[model samples]
Target chain A: MNFEEGKKQFIQTWGKLGSEWGINRTMAQVHALLLIAPKPLSTEEIMEELSISRGNANMNIRDLLGWNLVHKELVPGDRKEYFVAEKDIWEIAKRISRERKRREIEPVKSVLHQLQEVEGDRSKDEVKAFTDMMNQLGGFVDKMDKSVDIMLSSDQSWFFGMLLKLIK
Target chain B: MNFEEGKKQFIQTWGKLGSEWGINRTMAQVHALLLIAPKPLSTEEIMEELSISRGNANMNIRDLLGWNLVHKELVPGDRKEYFVAEKDIWEIAKRISRERKRREIEPVKSVLHQLQEVEGDRSKDEVKAFTDMMNQLGGFVDKMDKSVDIMLSSDQSWFFGMLLKLIK
Candidate 1:
């Protein structure tokens, strides 16, 4: 396929992938456009290209910034803010992992821990089963939490290298 | 919370958490119910508990079965098919990762690989950049693919043990 067609295909695929990763379609499309564009793009350019309203563009861009997936760029003479996505694929994955760990993993782990305090007889099958389930799930999350911490501290080459070795 | 209350809360939370992980709300709820239920539930029971229609319940249950999250059981002397979730959390997680690897990661890697063959002058900035991006993303996916394969082959205790040690 040609350049324009390839670019379009990339954005569409990225959008769908984003939905699977818990990101909304519009935000993913915006990020996809910025990721593929040769340079930083202004909000108007983003809205025009994606056929989105100004409000929609503004909201998704703000959400992207919150996710640390996009950054604000300042044009030399232009007053309007421009935005660009973190193009390095490794960095993008790290940012996503960090945010999800904080948003989803941390809270869930906390709840699982708290459930250990359920006042009940440990000998009862129902009570033991429930507590055991929580403890098992909690333990798994702890390991994962530590693993991601180690991963985020290392560079992509080192992380992938370790993963490759461990997988073998 | 008491056992029943805590169970209800856990189901609700799991359903919401499932949405963030790309499982739709109703399907997740159905899975959550089955996971906590003492025994297999018929389609009518699942529908009544979740307040979902027969078609909706059937479709989601079929989808869950396809994902290996739920299984069909034949109750003695009962004509209706009953369903049970794979209640072991580790097994549940393993099934999800395995399915996602098949449905999303593998196909995405294939496309990214094909994009490398886009016939164009390599010297052009856009062409070179797009090709490079795809290659990097593809490489990350490749590493993840291998990592998952290894994880899937092992039991939960062994896999998580290795992960904890590696991270430490």
Candidate 2:
């Protein structure tokens, strides 16, 4: 396949993957574009290459910046801001894992803790059984979250390999 | 916390986690409810507990079923379908892995393969680079998926322990 067609297909596929993971398509497409670019690209360049609206280009760039996946670049004697993505796939995975843990896991842990205090009919066997099970599940998630936290703290593959050993 | 407050917190947190991972809020809440229920719940019961519209409940329930995370149960002398989540959390995780592989990863891989055929100068370079990276990623995910499949297929803890040893 030719360069332009191949680039377009890559962007489309990456964008679809992003949407399935709960991110907007344009954001993923912009990331894909930045991933393959040889140098930092200006917003205008991104807009032209992706055939996206100015607002979309601007918004997604900001979101990527917030995720620490993309960054603003200053060009000598250039007025327009340029952007680039983190080139290392491993670093990208770390950032994603940290963000997910912070945004999703921690909050869920807090709620699960609160739920454990519910004084629902302790005398009733069913209610007791349900709460007991919920407690067990909550404890399980909490342990997993701790393991994820440990994994996120380092770039050590051996640590994860060890944890994987413990799963059974 | 009181029962009402605790339940509310649980639902809200579960919904937030779901959204971050690409599942909708209602779908996650329904799953969470099923996780804690002592018995299989009828659709009407789920609607009442969650205070969601019938259509919304039906749609999310169907999604959960498609993921194989929820099962339909036949009640004696009852026409209304009952639902229950797989009680094993590990099993639930394995099902999610398989479903996501089918629904998301496979499609992305197919497109990546197609993109490799695109011809052109810079575009070909871009396509080759993107497809190469995706292929590597696909392999990683495929291995982890296979591990999950094997883990769920039997009650053998020693094999899982061995796989975790490999990961570590």
Candidate 3:
């Protein structure tokens, strides 16, 4: 692939994958472009390379930054800001896991917890049942989140090696 | 919560989460209902409970089955197929991880591999950059999936023990 072709393929595929995983398409594409760039890219550079509008590039770049997937940069001599993705794959994964947990899991847990507290004798069985099930699910999700934390915190080589063994 | 309130809250919250995660509202609500139900429920029952159109119910039910999140139950002497969610939270998580990996990671890997095969010096640099980044992301995802597999494959006691530690 030529530079243009490779960049196109990268943006398109990354955008598609992002939508599949619940992120918006442009946000993912912006992250992809930043991920592979040799240096922090300015917003104008991103707009030019992707052929996206300035507003679109600006908005999506902000979204990626909000997700902690990309970071802002200021060169010593540069007036405009540049952006870079979290380069270490493990760190990228860790930040994503943490953000998703906050956005998805915590809210679900809160709702489930509140639902568990409602009272009534005639409906007590159903309430008890709902709470018990929610508690169990919550606990399980909590465990999975812990596993992610532990995996992220551990030495990458050791964790990956152990994970590889477990998979087989 | 009373049965009506608790049930409504559960469905609404689950539906919201599902939409945020790319699944539709009714599909998530249906799954949420099934998640806590003590018994398998028929299609008509689901339609009635959810007040969804027959086509919508059928389609989303099929999707859930496809994701391995739900399954058919044939009650003795019953002509209609009933549905139930996989009750084990760990199992549910595992199936979700596997299905998501198959849907998202595998396809991206194929694209990455194809991009990696394009030939030319300058082209190769771009191709190499995208392919290498994607391959790294793919590898990390595969490893994370393995960790999920390990948790799913563990014996009941072992799994619960981990859950206990996590909850604390």
Candidate 4:
């Protein structure tokens, strides 16, 4: 396949993958487009390239910025804002890992903590078992939370370098 | 709050969390229900509890079974097939991580592998940069794949035990 064809296929496939994981299709597609693009693209250019409505394009771009996946760039002497994705693959992975931990893991952990304090009679089997389950699950997630915290705070190259060695 | 109230809130909130991560709302809800239920639940019980249609309940339960999060229990003297979630949080988590690696990461890695083999003028800057990005991304994902494989093959407690120590 030609470069353009391969690029298009990649973007589409990536977007579908994103949707399966819970991200909106448009947002993933926009990120995919930015990933393959050789240079920064403007809102207008993004809309035109993706053949999406202005509102859809704008919203997804804003969300991308919120996730730290994309950033605004100023072309020399041009007032128009151009958007560029963090092209470093490692950085992309880091941003995603950190953001997801913040968005998904942290909130769930908070709820688990609260649920652990549920006022109840511990004598009854039903109540005892339920609370015990919650505590066990809570502890499991707590461990995972710590693991994610370590991952987010550490530098990728050194961390993964040592990790690959240890795991291997 | 009472056990019932807390359980209800937990299930709802957990389902929302799953949605953000790319699992559909209903499937997550079903899993949540099974998670909190003290005993195995039959199709009728699940449907009534969730107030969902039979098809919806069955489909989601089947999906949960597929994901290794839920299992069938054959009760003595009961013809109905009852389902119980893998209430052990560690096992549930391991299943999810392993399944996601197979479903999402592996496919993307394969595509990246193929894209790296794109036949083109290697001397051109465009071709070079694009291929380099793919390679870098592919390499990073491969490292992740290896990490996941290790996690899957090893005992959860031992793996997490060693990992927590290493990360610390």
Candidate 5:
């Protein structure tokens, strides 16, 4: 494959993977484009490259910024804003983990905690089953929460190194 | 909250969480309904509880079975087929990890491998950057693949036990 062919394949694959993980396809494609770019790209450049509408590109770029996956860049003597992705894969992983924990895991944990307060007779099978399931779900989410925290706080080498050792 | 209210909240929350993670909202809702039930639920029961059409319920239930998250149960002497979710949280986690690894991660890795063969002059910056990015991404994904494999092969207590220790 040539450079252009390879780049296209990378972007398409990344976008598909992102959509499977709940991200919008166009947004992930934008990120993929930025990831392989040698330098920051202006909005006009991004629009031409991806063939996306300006509004669509703008919306996804804003969302990516909110997620801390992409950043705005101002070129010297240039009026247009440029965008770039954080290319360090480890840092990218950590940032995504952090965002997901905040957005998804933490909220679910809160709901699980609230469900624990459901009023009922303890001996009733219906109540007992509900409480038991909640407890189990709560415990699992807590473990996942802690795991993400550890990943966010620790360096890649130490974390993966230790994990690899344990696995073996 | 009363038992009925709590059940509603739990199902709603789980469904929302699932959608954020790329699972269909109705599918996750159906899984949620089955999760808290004290006994297996029939297709009719699932449709009534979720307010879904028969076709919709059947589709999601089929998907759940494909993902290995839910199973069909034959209640002895009953004409209708019943369904149940895997209630063990650890097992549920493992199954999801396994399915996702097969469905998503492995294919991405394969594409990364193929992209490595992109023909280009090593001295050219564009070619160099693309190759370098692919290598880095390939390495990171390989590590993740190994980690998921370890999680799948180990018992929950032993896996989480070691992971917790390592995290600290």
Candidate 6:
């Protein structure tokens, strides 16, 4: 494939992948576009390239900035603000994991903890099953919480190296 | 919380978590209902308890079966099919990871590989940046693929034991 074709395919695939992982498609597409751009791009350029409406492009860019995956860049003489993605793939991964942990894992873990304390009759099979499942789920969520914490805090090479060794 | 309140909260939380991870709300809710159920649930029971239409419950149950997360059980004297979720938490995690790897990771990696082969002038900064990004993404995806494979193949206790140790 040529450069243009390759770039289109990448953005499309990235958008689909993002939607599957609970992100909006336009947001992921915006990120994909910025990821390969030679320099920071103005919002209008992003809208034109992606064939997205101004509002759609602007909303996603703002959300991306909130996630710390993208940043604002000011050109020396231009009045318009430009955006750039965090080009370091490892940093991108860490940011996403940290955000997901905070948004999904933390809330779920909190609920799981509360559910585990349900007042019930232990001898009853219904109560027994519910409590047991809560305990199991709570334990699993705790492990996941710890795992994300370690991933966020550790150096990329050292963390992946040890993980790869253990997996092997 | 009382048992009923706890059950309601758990289902709501699980459904929210599922939607955040790209699963539909009702499907996740159905799965949540099964997770804490003391006995295999009939379609009618599920619909009534969740206040969902019969079609909705049936569809999600079918999907859960497709994901290998739920199974249909036939009671000796009853003609109606009963459904049960895989009660083992570790097994559930492995199944989800495996499915996601097949659905998301494999396809993205394929596209990344194709994008990496884009014919371009190496001297062009745009081409150079795109190729470099694709290569970096490909490497990370490969590592993730291997990690999932290891998780799938290893015994639960052994895998978690080693992983927890490494994280510490």
Among the candidates, what TM-score does chain A have in each?
0.95, 0.88, 0.86, 0.91, 0.97, 0.97
The order of the candidates by DockQ, greatest first, is: 5, 6, 4, 1, 3, 2
Q: What tens-digit string does per-residue lDDT give for candidate 1 at A1-168?
A: 877777788888889988987789999999888887778889999999999999999999999999999999998888999998898888888899999999998988887777655767778766776777777777878878887887787788877676567654
- Segments in model 5 whose C-alpha atoms lie over 4 Å from true places: B166-168
- Each candidate's number of clashing pairs is 0, 17, 1, 2, 0, 0
Residue range A53-84, candidate 6, lDDT tens digits: 99998999999999999999998888999999
Measured over the true interface residues after superposition, the C-alpha RMSD of each candidate is: 2.0, 4.4, 3.3, 2.0, 1.3, 1.3
Error of 2 at B161 (Å): 6.8
lDDT per residue as tens, model 3, B16-37: 9988888778989999999978
Minimal lDDT window, size 10, model 3 chain A: A118-127
Residue B92 C-alpha lDDT in model 3: 79
Q: Lowest-lDDT window of 10 residues in candidate 6 chain A?
A: A159-168
Model 4 regions more than 4 Å off: A166-168, B166-168
Note the DockQ of each predicted structure: 0.54, 0.46, 0.49, 0.57, 0.78, 0.77
Off by over 4 Å in 2: A153-168, B113-168
The stretch of ten residues in a row with the least summed lDDT in candidate 3 chain B is B159-168
Task: State residue B114's C-alpha deviation in candidate 3, in Å.
Answer: 3.8
Of the pair 1 and 6, which is ahead by lDDT? 6
On a 0 to 100 scale, what is the lDDT of residue B147 in model 1?
84
Model 5 accuracy (lDDT, Cα):
0.91
Candidate 1 per-residue lDDT, tens place, B29-105, comes to: 89877776767899999999888899999999999999999999998898999998887877887899999999988
